[model samples]
Target chain A: MTNKRVYNFSAGPSQLPLEVLETARDQMLNYEGSGMSVMEMSHRSSTYQKIFDDTKATLKRLMNIPDNYKILFLHGGATQQFGAVALNLMDKGRADYVVTGNFSKKAAQEAAKFGDVHIAYDGKDNNYTHIPTQDELDIRDDIDYVHICQNNTIYGTEWNYVPDTKGAPLVADMSSDILSRPVDVSRYGVIYAGAQKNMGIAGLGVVIIREDLIKPHKENIQVLAEYDTMADKDSMYNTPPAYAIYVLGLVLKWVEKQGGLEEMEKRNIKKAALLQDYLDQSDFYIYETEKGSRSRMNVAFKTPNKDLDAKFVKESIEAGMTNLKGHRAVGGIRASIYNAMPYEGVEYLLQFMKKFEEENR
Target chain B: MTNKRVYNFSAGPSQLPLEVLETARDQMLNYEGSGMSVMEMSHRSSTYQKIFDDTKATLKRLMNIPDNYKILFLHGGATQQFGAVALNLMDKGRADYVVTGNFSKKAAQEAAKFGDVHIAYDGKDNNYTHIPTQDELDIRDDIDYVHICQNNTIYGTEWNYVPDTKGAPLVADMSSDILSRPVDVSRYGVIYAGAQKNMGIAGLGVVIIREDLIKPHKENIQVLAEYDTMADKDSMYNTPPAYAIYVLGLVLKWVEKQGGLEEMEKRNIKKAALLQDYLDQSDFYIYETEKGSRSRMNVAFKTPNKDLDAKFVKESIEAGMTNLKGHRAVGGIRASIYNAMPYEGVEYLLQFMKKFEEENR
Candidate 1:
């Protein structure tokens, strides 16, 4: 059979670079003369250790992460971190959470089980269509840490500026937007992202944390979830997700070769503009997210009606695109043009959208 | 270059069948004409959902899992389940733990944090060389469950008979020997394994639990760690390890085509016999595990001295073999020939051992 690669626009576990996939396929049988697939190598072997170390080093360099911060490749994704962040750091028994969208709301509820969780800001008042401005946040200095979801994938909203947490350490879940743009790693106590998005594959969670917050000896938490132990062991306390991390390493190298985060930010801005500019000009489509808080990763929009939106999604798949249907919570169309989604993919999507709009009208 | 596959025997995350690797490579670019890598597909997409369903169904059939059992794909490996098993099943405030080897000892310690843990039996007395018989276990009928390591990867031992836990339910960590032989799924309440061993790849944990044991609404535990939530959601409560599960499905299919577990057991017995028989007749090597308790997956042995053991490991690499080094806790050699290791691999290993024994002595 012919290798027919198409344009995939799923939100998380979304598209990856075709080049990266090809490289992975090439090395599937024998990885760098190791005489075995990366899937079969022992985590403790020197051959595999190099892959693990290089993956972390590339991420640290790409993020401009300081020596004080550790890059941890963990399992259970960012959803697991919702509890881990609180279990290890909520020593003061209270923390402020900004409920920007679906994931942030889940984080606040999960943290509530571990400590006294205070909602510093709730975007639900506006149907989670926008991120709250810094002045609108009610964060307290007494709290252990202030939590935020940097990018809301489902709601198609992104935090434009970091909130001042009144001296409290900041924790951000960048599951959808990490690696798409540059960020000040020093500003946050912890930043975690699941690998299924712009990073690479699923089953791995990348955590960048300030060294001081990692308490390996933290009581009541499992050893695997403890940031200190995972960091101390260099994230190999036991058998790690070897193949996922290897694929993640390959993706990071691909990003680095594309000229670091600055180039990524420039490209991302252009990709988002391609869709947003079209949405702005079109009268038939309605982009609900406020302009300032719109995400460069996920573009959630709707046609004139539900029936037409369904038809658009159905037709788009036949036209060589998939995963354009929006989240169920808010029915519409969402084109998650992540880093791997080439500019040409967006151009093709725009052409389809325009043709669908003209014909349906 | 040539795809030179070598003999790898490093316990967990060991070698996989070359056929599975070839199939994975063929489909790495576009999985079965879905036009996207499995890593890129959304968990909610019907195309990806079918992969997930087929994988779970294949595992259920291979294990002959009863209808009352729910199979879950989770993160954090079996180590994560060390805490998860206790958090979900320690409802009676305690459980009986049988400490057989490294993993079970760690599991017992982790379970101590959540509930009352009683050491039903400790094999450490024999330096973890053997599994205790039924009458030797001081298990309690009132406990929530009786925990055991079905196969000890580190110490090269296997439970020859399932210990009768009176009326208490049984929980086993089958990380090292899960699919190497037929198992009576109905006899155990819960059996969990890390995929890096007998299953496939790393970063994915397979939990086969009796439906009654799954407590999704179990208070005080994190949502992701709750077995009921994972089972109820059919292991898609969140973004799972997609690529790992896909590879696992391929491995399961390969095993099914190899005439299922009965055939696997037959081959495993022959392979283990080849090594054990050689060790039985050899005077230069020492196999410490009791005869009936020997693991077919991992064969741990030592030379007459530590120096020769090191030399044997160093020379084996040059002889087209790798990962023969033993666990650091016990400094010797451990040849982990899991289900994926062919009979010829074992034959080659025996050939090397004979040559090494003649030269070293």
Candidate 2:
């Protein structure tokens, strides 16, 4: 095994806390003297039940979730929730979606399959570089819920202000930026995230929803996709992603020890500012995202030309950083500095960028 | 951290090989000099892609899967596949289900939500103690597909012979007995199993389907649940359960080194026979499953009385064998000796059983 740990910056399924990995390794053979790895234990077993309960509890504590909200540890990632959200909450057979970037566009498309999906705001014309202002959103009052992706991993744009849905339930896909900042859990009817980015690892989806919103859907949706079924069974409808939830619990504990979401937001802001400041001044680089819409989690930028961008990605990997390549949909560079990404990693990237700019010019 | 590892007898999310766990622990911090844990890598990167490709390749090699079939590593367990099976394959809006045990019953119930599910054979009256004979299964000629749970973890029954479905395609949920022995992939239209049992861990479902059967469904189903969508995307439809797939690859490699399916069948038969033989001779305990229907994976048995059964379950844990308690649906003792369960583990359980029998008697 290599002693080196590179700064990984590919959107979701990205970097996890080193402490969590260490703890997981230490208990790989046996968990808490239980004689089986977390992976090997039955989800129904008391030992694994504790891990499941503690993970849900810690996330609730960190987010200050209301008593009316229930946390579900599910199998599929946020992509699965794109359909589940619409299937479960489209009680009126209609919903509104704010299409800010790639993921939101996909979510709207999936939701359209289940019911009448109205695109309240479309950012396609602006190349997904801008999050729509509340005034620009054409949310329908009769819709069941208003859907929005809180942060766009591909476009590097995040909704700076929560849209007023005029009393309608707000469902947000916070896959890339959930735990990186403090969230008003009461504001949204549901908030779901994939556990590969700000949490711990892949294989798990964390969904927090207001208890009242989790009623039986009118359609014949899959039982596993029904929020009420999961809530009623306490997310043990079937065997969960046991090991991923255990690791997520470890990561949550680490976040708690590091003073929780407020502290995470502080660090994330600083890290983003360091890179944003450099990109703003660099003559050879271009940060396309609108100033007000820039995301603190995923910082997307690129060199003046495609060849230089390719060279930058290659040289960055050689300089002990990898996965800085932008998403295939939008080719350039994207440095995803999630909660687990150290401030030093972004500083290192900035230093490399400075060197590259000087050499390229 | 404890140095001692106990024998875990969980049905699914069951025991994994000790060697696989060691390899995982050794490379927890750095996976093959990639400078990141497998959990931290991007699913799109070359490093992570290699892991994904290698895993699919190893499983295909071990199973001797045909070129006419495609393997998909998906989220959610076999529970999700229950609905996906009908939603994707119920082109005629009708299907036949063989309800042999608890899981098959659940699968049928889920499928009913999507289509007209006909129970061709049900062993409920037999207390799930027998698998239906081929002559007993009344598969309809007009049905789109016939579904069956090949091995029942809760009931400890297995279908020893595949039923002919006339011209209709066959779909088998091999969640419990997959990889325990050789499987003729061409016999079934689809064979899907949750990775927690004989494979590796929870959070992943391995779907093996004939290319011809993966056609577009008539109904509006979630894209993630569509077999054709997954087959088209090469199972990278969205971020997959990355770490679980990696561990599954390691387990598949271990099975390969142990001489593939023939050797696995030999070891599994030997282990199952040892336990079955002991139960057969013991007057105090009863193995309820019909001899011809007994599974070589999960061996379910009980004492003459409920109190004695509780005592047996309690004493087994004290004897360093855990998860001996049966499913809540059927309260007794269940020792799930999947492929990773060593013969010595069964030996230890037998030793404990013999002592418990003597004391109770």
Number of the top-ranking candidate, with DockQ as the measure:
2
Error of 2 at B147 (Å): 1.0
Question: How much DockQ does model 1 earn?
Answer: 0.70
Model 2 misses residue B204 by how many Å? 0.7
- True-structure lDDT of candidate 2: 0.91
Worst 10 residues of 2 chain B by lDDT: B1-10
- lDDT by residue (B1-361, candidate 2, tens digit) is 3357888898878899999999999989999898989988888888889999999999998899999999999999899999998888888899999998988999999999988999999898999999988899898879989999999999899989888998899999999998899989889999999999989999999999989888975447887898988888898888989999999999999999999999999999999999999999889888888999999999999888899998888877777788899998998899999989999999988888898889998
Instruction: Give the Å shift of residue B266 in candidate 1.
Output: 0.2
Q: Kindly list the per-residue Cα lDDT of model 1 for residues A1-361, writing each as its tens digit.
A: 2257788889989999998999999999999888988999999989999999999899999999999998999988998999989998988889999999999999999999999999999988798988898889998768899999999999999999988988888999999999999999999999999999999888888999998887655566777788888888889898888888999999999999999899999999999999999999899999879989999999999999999999999999888899999999999999999999999999999999999999998
What TM-score would each prediction reach against the true structure? 0.99, 0.99
TM-score of chain A of each: 0.98, 0.98
